[model samples]
Target chain A: MEPGYDLPAMIGMTEADVQTPALILDLDALEANIARMAAEARAMGVALRPHAKMHKSADIALMQIAAGAVGVCCQKVSEAEALVRAGVGDVLISNELRDGVKLARLARLAGRAQVAVCVDDAGGVAELAAAVAEAGTGVRVLVEVDVGAARCGVAPGAAAVPLAQAILAAPGLTFGGLQAYHGGAQHLRTEAERAGAIADVVGKVRQTLAALEAAGIAVPCVTGAGTGSFRHEGASGVYTEMQCGSYAFMDADYGRNLDAGGAWTSPFRNAMFMLAGVMSKTRPGHAVCDAGLKVMSMESGLPVSAREGVEYVGASDEHGTLADPGDVLRPGDRLRLIPGHCDPTVNLHDWYVGIRGGVVECLWPVTARGKHF
Target chain B: MEPGYDLPAMIGMTEADVQTPALILDLDALEANIARMAAEARAMGVALRPHAKMHKSADIALMQIAAGAVGVCCQKVSEAEALVRAGVGDVLISNELRDGVKLARLARLAGRAQVAVCVDDAGGVAELAAAVAEAGTGVRVLVEVDVGAARCGVAPGAAAVPLAQAILAAPGLTFGGLQAYHGGAQHLRTEAERAGAIADVVGKVRQTLAALEAAGIAVPCVTGAGTGSFRHEGASGVYTEMQCGSYAFMDADYGRNLDAGGAWTSPFRNAMFMLAGVMSKTRPGHAVCDAGLKVMSMESGLPVSAREGVEYVGASDEHGTLADPGDVLRPGDRLRLIPGHCDPTVNLHDWYVGIRGGVVECLWPVTARGKHF
Candidate 1:
């Protein structure tokens, strides 16, 4: 019933001409981040399975695959479906699913591509096996060991053995490995802190591996890591696959992470930005931009302005109040905003206006933008 | 390219069978909220203009209009376009637009609907008028006065007079009244605090009105109020139109606002919920649900669990950690989550599964979702 809402910008339009509240991707920066991550994973002797949950764009996922990523990791069945349908061959759902409908979808998706899912419970394994048997497809299953995230998965060591055994015995399912990602360790602020957190995570993963080895089951892969702690996990010897997502589109939160020397110098650069327009500038020392909670998420923190002398102070539903000390911002002026968090903020937009050399290069649809099933 | 991503649930399906991470709208509670808000507005002697930005659903906006709302308010040009194309005849963009492309779109949308927009600057008025003239349509224009909201709008008093006069002089534009919204006053916690905040807003609005009157300008309407402080603004007599959006879908943040007796006795009930499944329950005293920052915005705060003895403690990208001291929640179990904020949370979903008597009655498309021009 709805029409006439055009895309934010034309491909050849200048960055200044693009509409406000549009998600902009620096093409050069994104490519550099992808290449760097792929090289780093190769150098560290770990398979790179960049998380697709961050960008949720099939085009970006295909790019990572072309750059030598083994596959991509998604957190939801719907996301995997979106990517696989868009020609992605291998996808690993790095999280667990308990719903039968979702498991059925996952099994059906396995008929099309190489699909692997994580499980931490017997009920989940049973449901998944039923779906896969009904679909007549063999789906890879991984035992999710808690490892330090404490958010999901079975306990560290022996508790995962039964889950792995269940997967091995279930019809139309194969035990892939262990899903041991520690999500909490990704953003520990300091290099020492993140390294320490991953060290603990590696210990838990090793214990789980030893238990599985005792059970005479060979683990194919141990997938986990994030932008903050990927270096530690990549060198941990226990992790065989890295699922770093936000390294592709570094945000203000990741930019705040301290390096080994306690400096903010990181190999990755900010690639994603929210281009906002100054909608109202009537008040002195303050201006309102067209990007706020609706266009950018603020759970981690407020967006950081890319321009000097302007600070994004507060965000309402549709308006971001900027602290313009010099009152230089005027009506219709555009500003680039680095979101606090990449994944959730990227989820808020439909199209990523890819730009390079101050001009829009492409408009990639966030293929799985709202695929939250 | 995605062919397998089906709707979360079909019509007539049971609520328990609906997919996790789906946005559920309790139909009974939603209708009651709409009717009550309409009745309250009638009793308060003010026109109801429910903000469509909250739900972004054309179906919900139509229901509000059927219940006696004069029109609906939006915050973006594309949102107005979406609703207008979906048969919403009258739309008022409650916020300012500075980009020429968006203004042009807004002007064209006015050709198909009764469209009005707010402006706080001379340049905005000029650009809007030009677009309206180019489109050969007359558009209503409102002078937004900063009424205690430091985010946007011109200064409170005599500053509005020149802007209103400018609107009157511009071609294809008719000066409507003032757009004085105190967004920060909406969530003042206690009734006394909210009442005090709105009192200040009313005073500023009155000053602006007096200035406009002294300048021999007549204001046809004054629209701006929200769910939290609507009662105060409704009784102010200066605000002729109330723009309360969250009353139809109360959130955890609004649920925390206290009444006049310093108790949590709100007239509105929460009709909206995020139905998530317990994906992992391996750890004692803790469980992880399949809803997180992707499905729900946590800027205001984390979502409050609808079940007793289960508390939502933390959120990651795709998992919500619940503190289940009793360990009653198990894998595949469902929990209804009341999001901290309603507007942005609703934007994260594609469809609203409307339930009544524990069955899916309707699937409403969030028509204007992500239409952030």
Candidate 2:
């Protein structure tokens, strides 16, 4: 089925004519970011698997594939199903899946694409094996070790060995090595802190690899890294695959990350914007915009204004209050807002209006939006 | 168009068989809340126009209208259009519309339904008049007065007169009285604070009405009140309409609100839940659920767990971390999570699995889930 309405913009319209509270993509910057990441991954001798969880657009995924990305990484089976249906040939379910229905769906989806999933428990491995056997499909399974992020995965070193052995013993499943990711360490404020976190992650991954080797299991690939700390992982000589998603569309939260010189990292530019229109300017020092928490996720933080002297102060359900001390904003004025976080914010919209040279270039559907199951 | 996939669950399926991270509604609690609000509105001698911006479901709006509501209130033109297309007879755009494209759409939408919109500027009045004239349709225009929420609306009292007069002078427009809403007042921690804020709102609305009366203008309806402070507005003797939306599906944020006796309010029960499945249980005192920020909004706060000894602590893109102090949760275990905020949380899913007697009875689409433009 298609979306309930038309696309947010046409192919030839100007940016000014595009609808408010729409996701706007800078096409020039997006292409540059994609090319840069591909080149960097090649230089580091690691396979690039851009996470589709950030953009959720099949068109962008195809572009990354054409630019030498191995495949895309998604978090859920439904998301992988959407992307696979849209011709994303290879997908990695980066997190664990324990529900039987989802496992069955994943097993069926594996028939259409090269599908893999991560698991930290033997019970999950058994359930996945049953689903794959029922569907008569072969699927890859990765042993997820808790490198640093304490939220998911089993304990790092020897804890990954049992899950690997379980996957190897299963008939329809293949051992796909370890999934080691430190989500919290990706957002460390300083480069030194981030490097230290990745150093710890590399040590844990090495210990897991030693345990697998001792068990006579040959590890194929180890994947885990994000936009914030991919450089460290790429240079570590241990990570075989990189799963960086948000590098293509940098956000305010990432913009706050510092480099070795104590300046904002220059590897990527902000390529996506939440384009909002001022609908109310009644208050003297404040103006209300059409974008709010419904249109853009504020869980990370409030969006940063692209224009100087105008700061986004607060957000409600349907309105964003701007601290426009200069009182320069008026009704119908459009503003490009840098979202605080890229992933959940992109999930809030249906389409992305790609613009270049101030003109609409393309429109892509967020194919995997709301596919959280 | 239909959604990209099939419904999460079929009728007659048990709650346990439904997909993870799906929106579940308790039909009994929903019916009770609707009946209670309808009776309260009747006793208060005011019209009920439940806000569709919260639920965004035509089925619920129809249920309210069937019970005795005059119509429904929405925050966007696209939202009103979606509801109207779904057979809702009447809708009010409770927020301002300044963009010409949206104004034209709203004007065209009025041709098929009883449509009204709020405005605070004379320029907005002119634009609405032009759009209505172009479409050859009439729409009701309410002068939005700044009653306590400083985000939108003009200053209260005399500031509303010129806009009301402009609406009277415009073609294809009718002056529909004042839109006086105190959004910030609704969430005040204490009952006394909410009452004080609403009292101030009543005073401002009263001043605006007196000014309009002095100018020989007749006010037809005074609209605005949410679930948080609707009691104060209902008893204010100034508000003619109450727009309580969350009362239909109470959330954790609203559950924190205190009554006059320093207890949780007893008027509404939580009728909605985000049904999730535990995907990982590797840690000693923690488990990861399939639902996270992508499935449920976390701007208001983390979701409240329905089961004892389990608390939703942190959320990433696709995983919810649960603090399971008793370590009772295991992989594939189901959970009923009360969302932090009802409105945006409902916006994250495509369908609502309505449960009655532990079985799925109905599946209602969130008709206006992403109609933010």
Model 1, residue B268: distance off in Å is 1.2
Q: What TM-score, to 2 decimal places, does chain A of model 2 have?
A: 0.97
Model 2 residue runs over 4 Å out of place are A1-5, B1-6
Model 2's alpha-carbon lDDT is 0.91
Error of 1 at B178 (Å): 0.5
Clashes of each: 0, 0
lDDT of 1 by residue, B79-159 (tens): 898899899999999989887788888888888999999998888888998999888999999988888887788888899
Q: With candidate 1 superimposed using the best TM-score fit, by how many Å does residue B58's alpha carbon deviate from the native?
A: 1.2
RMSD of each: 2.1, 2.1
Badly placed stretches (over 4 Å) of model 1 are A1-4, A262-265, B1-4, B262-265
Q: Model 2 over residues A55-174: C-alpha lDDT tens digits?
A: 999999999999999999999889899999999999999988887788888998989999999998989999999999999999999988899888888887788888888899999999
The lowest-lDDT stretch of 10 consecutive residues in candidate 2 chain B is: B1-10
Mind sharing the TM-score for model 2?
Answer: 0.98
Docking quality of model 2: it rates as: medium
What is the TM-score of model 2 when looking only at chain B? 0.98
**DockQ per candidate:** 0.69, 0.66
